[model samples]
Target: MSKVRAFTILEMLINLTIMSIIMGLIYFAYASFVKQVINYQVSIDEQNELTTSYVQLRTDFFNAERIVKSYKGFKVIPYNNKEIEYKITDKYLIRRQVHMLDTLSINKLTISSDFNIITKEDLITKMIVETTLFDEPIEFVIAKDYAPNLKLKL
Candidate 1:
């Protein structure tokens, strides 16, 4: 009789089982890696958004002619016979500057804040504003060189 060259039924079954196990393991690993990458990307995006928002807020505060106490969830600044109000509302940092003889409508800016408090230690001959992002509770520290010397409650 001629020698058999094909795999036996038992050998084929074992080979198929081994291949299935290997494929399952590979799929599991791939899924795990994908999840990790997504999580990391989300974290990075959040951090970048927080940084950008904080910088914009800091810049506004630094350029303001005054920084008054918090009123109605806002800080008022008097500039050129007009009032500029900075406040946190609905998970946004809004600035409403009312110019003389202008409509009472307020302008809106995209920003947010957290439960962060400003400390004197973070000031360098200027006022330091610290806050957190709306989506995140983590605090952000911001400093500006121009201090308006507006009296405010710590």
Candidate 2:
């Protein structure tokens, strides 16, 4: 008779245990990678939102005929007779128009002017918008020069 050798039950069980541990480790690594990817994606989305809001505000400022201080925030009146209002809060900046509303998330915001019209206390000539986006601070300055023929709010 020829001699034969085979794996013992104990050895088989140990092998299965080792394989199970390896699979668990692989699963753990994959799960952690997926979680990190989700976090990165969320950060990118936040950055995009901040950029879009900044662009919209800049466009409105550039096209504005006049910008006036309001109780909540400020008003942008364009040459085309459209009224846009921006409401600022501790954590958000809300933009409202005829039929649309846009809420922008921000860390901090400060709106001011370098100087105003001497005759009109509320007439904002140059708007200085200081805000923090995604932990970085930035500023935007929008100014509108008026012609003698243009009408004043006063």
Worst 10 residues of 2 by lDDT: 112-121
lDDT of 1 at 113: 31
Expressed as tens digits, the lDDT of each residue in 1-154 for candidate 1 is 8987999999999999999999999999999999999988887876676566566556656665544445344453435535566555444455565542211112232223322145322222233333443343444444433333422422
Q: Which residue pairs clash within candidate 1?
A: 93-111, 114-132
Superposed on all Cα atoms, the candidates' RMSDs to the truth, in angstroms, are 10.3, 3.4
**Taking the candidates one at a time, how many backbone clashes does each contain?**
2, 0
- Winning candidate number (TM-score): 2
Task: Please identify model 1 stretches exceeding 4 Å from their true place.
Answer: 68-71, 75-85, 89-137, 141-154
TM-scores for every candidate against the unseen true structure: 0.56, 0.78
TM-score of 1: 0.56
lDDT of 2 by residue, 1-154 (tens): 9979999999999999999999999999999999999989987988788788878988887788777777778888888978999998877789999899998765556555423445453545665556665577777665666544344424
